[model samples]
Target: MFAARPYEDVLMDDIAQQAGVSRALLYRHFPSKHALFAAVYQQAADRLLAETKLDPTDSLVGQLVQGMDIHLDYFVANRHAVLAANRVLAGDPVIQTIMTGELDALRARLLAVLPLADESARRTVSAVLKSWLVFVQILVVDWLTEQTCSRTELRDICVGAVLGALRPLLPADLVPNWPQLAAGRAGA
Candidate 1:
């Protein structure tokens, strides 16, 4: 329903009818449409986070590329659900909080792997990672909805965006292997 129409336009009666449940039953389970959307978003976010966990043994670039792959895969596989979630982003505080919290967890995981010299450097890297993640979400939504780019191309673009952000902050040794890492090899 979200893929076909905006969440605001999807009536609770329509949802209950589609689910073959009585309105009373639906309301019993979810007091409001916002509650239902929040439940859906939380489930999807938790699943994605679990599925895309970073490998501690992989190089930073490799881990990033793999994580991008996981995200793109999930988005593609659950296009309807993802689109629905995106449409409801403005309606509910609980849903927004769930989305933000998941993104923050992802940022923290990536920051842990990045090599930084001090608290200030870590802060800078974390900020860059968070900003790039927003870009990733937007781009992923666009790519999946528009079918403008191949999956591999989209993944490469995401990897490039992150690597570009980290270039000046990362060491020379760690900088050269980004492309290779995107191709499924670890950087030295």
Candidate 2:
């Protein structure tokens, strides 16, 4: 019931009535509406994170494409819930901390898969990856709102852009494969 209703509309009485429980009982579990809303946001974040799988064997570009696809899939499928969580967490310090930690963990996971030879290269790659991830997020949100293209088409464009940017940074073997991928994607 809470999930279906807007956070502001989910009064204790409404939840209690929906659950066939007294208001006091609901209060016993969650002290306030904000606490209950936070719990819902945390659960949603956890579920979304669990749904994202990273393949260790894939190249950095491949892994990024996979991650982007998963992210877009989640956003497309759960737009309302995600937008609700975004609104609730936007100004919440505790939620910001959690979000930062989650992003750091994801960065570390990607770093683990990337082949950085030197400290400078590692730092440079990390910065690029972080920026690229944010760019992808913004692009996805814009694409969603505009309905400018199919998700697969948007994904291809995003993937192509990132791969093009990373080409100079990658080894010869990887560099050659990118053009082929770009050509294949374009032809599709």
Candidate 3:
């Protein structure tokens, strides 16, 4: 139902019938449609997070570039679910809380791998990391709507944005060889 119609148009009865379950059974598991939607959103979000995880062997730059591709691919494949999740995100406090938690987890993961010299630089990088996460989401949504650039172009731009934003805060020794590390890449 969600695939064919907007989230608001999906009725509990339709879901129950499609799932070969009674409405009472469905309600027993998910008290409301909003709850059921949130559960699905959680699964999608988890998949996104899983895909975005950094490979332990990759450099910081490599991780960033890889994550950009993973993020964009997920958006491209799950556009409808992403749209519905975004709507639920705006109107539902429970979903909002779950997203906040996911953001915090992402932040923690970035901080763990990001190379900064001191607590002060780490704090600054942390802020930049969070802001860049939000920027990626906004840029992808806009790109999906406008088709202003190809996916490769979008990935290049996003990776460049993240590296450029963090360059000043990162230690000189920690900086990767941009031209060599991500050579022939659109953003590199």
Q: Report lDDT per candidate.
A: 0.79, 0.69, 0.76
lDDT of 1 by residue, 50-136 (tens): 987787678776687788888887787777667766654645578668879989999998887777899999989899989999898
Off by over 4 Å in 2: 1-12, 17-20, 175-188
Q: Model 1: residues >4 Å from true position, as ranges?
A: 1-21, 177-188
lDDT of the structure predicted as candidate 2: 0.69
- Which tens-of-lDDT digit does each residue in 1-188 have in candidate 2? 44555556567888888889999998999898767766766676677567666776766667767777887887777664455555645678766665566566667777777676888888877777677666775677667558899887778777777666667776766544665775676687
Better of 2 and 3 by TM-score: 3
Score candidate 1 by lDDT: 0.79
Instruction: Judging by lDDT, tell me the better candidate of 1 and 2.
Output: 1
Query: Considering summed lDDT, which 10 consecutive residues are worst modelled in model 1?
Result: 179-188
TM-score computed on alpha carbons, candidate 2: 0.77
Tell me each candidate's RMSD, in Å, in order: 3.4, 3.1, 2.7
Point to the candidate with the largest TM-score: 3
For TM-score, candidate 1 versus 2, the one ahead is: 1
Clashing pairs in 1: none
Tens-digit lDDT string for candidate 3 (65-143): 7777777777787676566766545667877777777777777888898756789988888899889888887787778
